[model samples]
Target chain A: MTREPDSHYSSGNEAVIGWDIGGANLKAVRLSREGLQVVQQPFAVWQRRDELAEALARIAAELGPAPCAAVTITAELSDAFRTKRDGITFILDALQSALPETELKIFGLDGKFHHPAKAYQQPMLVAAANWLATALLVARDLADCLLVDIGSTTTDITPIGGGKVLAEGRNDPERLVRGELLYTGASRTPICALVQRVPLWGGWCPVAAELFATTQDAHLLLGHLPAEQCASPSADGRPATPEYALERLARVVCADTELLSQAEVQAIAQYIANEQIHQIAGAMTQVLSRVKVVGPVAAVGAGAFLAEAAAARLGLDYLRPATLARGAASVAAPAVAVALLLNEEACV
Target chain B: MTREPDSHYSSGNEAVIGWDIGGANLKAVRLSREGLQVVQQPFAVWQRRDELAEALARIAAELGPAPCAAVTITAELSDAFRTKRDGITFILDALQSALPETELKIFGLDGKFHHPAKAYQQPMLVAAANWLATALLVARDLADCLLVDIGSTTTDITPIGGGKVLAEGRNDPERLVRGELLYTGASRTPICALVQRVPLWGGWCPVAAELFATTQDAHLLLGHLPAEQCASPSADGRPATPEYALERLARVVCADTELLSQAEVQAIAQYIANEQIHQIAGAMTQVLSRVKVVGPVAAVGAGAFLAEAAAARLGLDYLRPATLARGAASVAAPAVAVALLLNEEACV
Candidate 1:
């Protein structure tokens, strides 16, 4: 892997922070002119929305004092349409309330920061920034690359060309319904809504209304989702455990087995694993159809199953960031790519 | 085929009307002493809730002057918890308002009609009536059977025992989440939420967010959902067509293959078909697991593909009712079975 150029510590003390607010977990990293440094303590915003402000305050306290902070928020608080704007507003408001002294910049699709100097309303820019960061950090040769960031509630498949992220779709509901927003995500996705049928030993089986298992359980069983990730919060703030995952999965389809026999549950888990892999692969193919990329695809997400499955299915080389970066780098490729682009543009 | 007893239709005025309010279609059968005359009109209520009430009013006007009517509301319109009682009340009020002079009795799961004379609610009475009608007029010798009804938004799988419908699972959302409600249906089901991956030529593929197609299109292409069924009124009162079905199906997965080659579109259609068949088969297996039945499975719905796929996968005999009476007959079988038991108990 090519190492990033030595950090050029700018005179400005302003720092940029990227936050990935998912349905199950909240991840944030702090980056300065020096580079990314873990804030030491990360905030956990699970089911309790009321605690969000407090959590951000705690995170802010750990970050000490900074001149300015950039925040990007994405979560599965509700259906796509219901939560998108509100979720962003909530996070921004909370951050502003918590760190009142810092120069707060809320990032949208626009690459420009939402601050006093630059009034940027472009959502694609922020999306591109995230995408760019991911590409630069992971795929150094960002040109002709497709960056897929699969999260809990949705997936973002972006094409990179000429060292710039291409934004073909909107991240909103109407666009989401129109194929702009990839709906299939890793956590909290209803299984019944996934595969219509699960092939059994003798015949096919249909899922019941009950939540039998979630993709989390399937990934856990396959050892794709690690214990650390599993222990994170669910869509609601509740701690996500193997038991919770199993209980949710068990409810996917109603069966007599209250606590499914290990074999039976495993069968469902395997089915989900196969389906998830299939979905990720299908998305990769779609991205490939649009852009002619020279190198292997790059994936950045907490969902290891998604990345691994896509890599294996496409028979392409894949890379995961060695260590999580602060700010946007938590998402890897996009964060790094965005940072690189910003740095180059600044130099020019 | 067993003939109905002469006494079954001896009374010229003894007739009962069965109304099934499904998410996609509204089916009404007037079983008078003169025989069953079925009037089936399809309507889409996904976006238009008022149209549902108007459609029911029109049906009531057409069935005017009937002594009594048994209406079953099965759709997303009525939440079991909040609107179960209110839903029944609304339907009865509508029916009463339409048929001012006729005596209309609303049917509830409790088995007893809500009338001034009844002190206790006999929930199983409706099941008994449905069972009696089926056994008396349709399946005479079939003792144990599974009734699968695939509607627009949901599927109902009822098990029959000793001529009575087994009442074990709750038909509402609570029980639905527990196993009673299977949310997968034939049409209008969002596709993006279905499978994680699609099968490409050699490997699996992930689905994009574009509205591609739905199970409705799959069934239509596969010749399972009939042209007549496909012609149901959309929410806008426009007649549905093959192109519309394709559009709807594509919308499920957020795929718009109108620009795609026929071969490519066909492949996507096939993938949807595979998922739908799998879903139906899975649900069928769930019902089969709970009850030990010897006879073939009986399916009645607009989704012929689901029934055929389920039957073929399970190696069970599949029976389709010739007319709309199939639903009434299916429900009647268990009703009759229980009635027989009640009769035997009374005699003892």
Candidate 2:
């Protein structure tokens, strides 16, 4: 991973799509001369690699027409490709193929944008480096603060100080060792993984070892997440309603309405949520242990609730990324951040 | 919830298929006057209600031909039907349509064999009654013992004494309360649901909430399960290899090989397995709290290892049904048990 000087951080004017693509899903933000739009879509790349171009076309269609695009991807780590180089080459080829003759640029680990040919040459600089875009953007707003972005399937934690990215590890594996990354998230997590035992009939009972319930169920039951925000193809392939969530959570302990009361299931959901908060907090603590918080912690991504809870537990101030990007935009912060950066580059 | 006496347990002679139909899968055993055969197949009844008839026919064909059939069902609990009665009627109709003029007898909760007419009149008695068939067959060998049958997605623990089923809870709700049943299993169960945090590099980390891995992975890594023993639609839809398992289990802690070593993931798997056993043991202890174990515990089902571990933890003698049925036959103990009973009745 390389760090670059900001001498080229100038301004130009045009529309740009800041794309943050990952193994299981895709997120993007379109910033035109008119305005900006942030979007997130689920795309199981490993299951169907061919449809990715179609998905991008659809997302772009939703964002309206654009002649310029900048991309940062984590999807390269997916087993669909043989190596990081293969993944980056494939992604670049996808962009070149889908938007021929369009001005396409890739975000590099060195903090600059590159044409596809150049980006492909240093694949390591472009492999799964989207988080840096968000961190770099956050550094512009606040110095000496921790950033937590929890998506549906994973969480990214990074530290920035003195208007600079200070992450010890710029790569996924390094971030994990330093506690700046965790795989847990707000949704899609099976509840059984959060805790072994749950309160049942006045005693703690072990949860079932099935995909009967997920973090989405817990969040839905607790009223922290809206129905529309729930992941489709839910844990049970049923609607992510509180009722269905109750059914799902009950299965964690191997029960149904016939066997467990709604109240008992509710208790189990609460227990899971608490354990999840603690899990996130543990990672956050590991990252923030050395540095004392002087200001609010930035909470971005779909699972901001977990970050908020972790910050509270640590007695650190918590700031929602939505305060700057707003609802859907915050959910797709990295994409939006890149879009903003690209727009700035265009303005010059 | 009813128990039948031996007066109706007469002998006859014919080939019989003992069918245990569940909401998501089917387990069947064909018992001829001479020998026995056990089989299992996945059938998501809810997703394809109309295909139930075809599924049964296919399963029967796999077992060759049968002159008579004794059926025990749990598929009624599936939402495919509005009520247990509807599920029973649907299943019976499917059986009749698939096997015209074939002698069909349904196992009622009362422990008596009922003609379709009688079984249809009160569907509740015939719903999810396979457990009784297994317990009754076990009673023939050890009247005073606990039957722990761990399947792919559930575990059934029943108490038998004095040559009769002594479970206080006849229905699912009652059974859940008495710790006589658990939804945890050995293969299909998601590993995340088994534990909140797994032991890792000198510490504990929350397992990935995704379907990144399953108990099958732990067992695979530990060498207790063969690759062939893995479920077809694996927890992550990947090959059931130790290497892939490492990738899956590492995700539990949100790490990849980059951040974690192979040794670390192996530890995580071992930790998950231990926690899963403890979970089963906890439930087992709750159920046996009020009883004195005078004989060996009957350990059956796909997850019998978990039950066996729990039994060893509790200092009880654990008996593998394979000792009585052997190999795959033990995996389908309930199916085999009912088939044996059906063959005896067919002889009479």
By TM-score, the best candidate is 2
Native-to-model Cα distance after best TM-score fit, residue A186 in candidate 2, in Å: 3.3
Candidate 2 interface RMSD after superposing interface residues? 4.1
Candidate 1: residue A164 lDDT (0-100): 68
Choose the strongest candidate by DockQ.
2
Tens-digit per-residue lDDT, A1-348, candidate 2: 011212222224666777888887788776655556667777878778888888887777776666778888888766565456777788778877766756887888788888778888888777767788888888888876788898887788888888888777666555665677777778877666667678887866655555566889989999999888885456667888898888777666645665577788888888888888887888888877866545578999889888899889878888875334466666777777777777767522
Per-candidate total of colliding backbone pairs? 95, 24
**Candidate 2 local lDDT, residue B86:** 70
i-RMS values of the candidates, in order? Answer: 9.0, 4.1
lDDT, candidate 1, at A67: 54
Sort candidate 2 into its docking category: acceptable
Q: Candidate 2 versus the native: TM-score?
A: 0.84
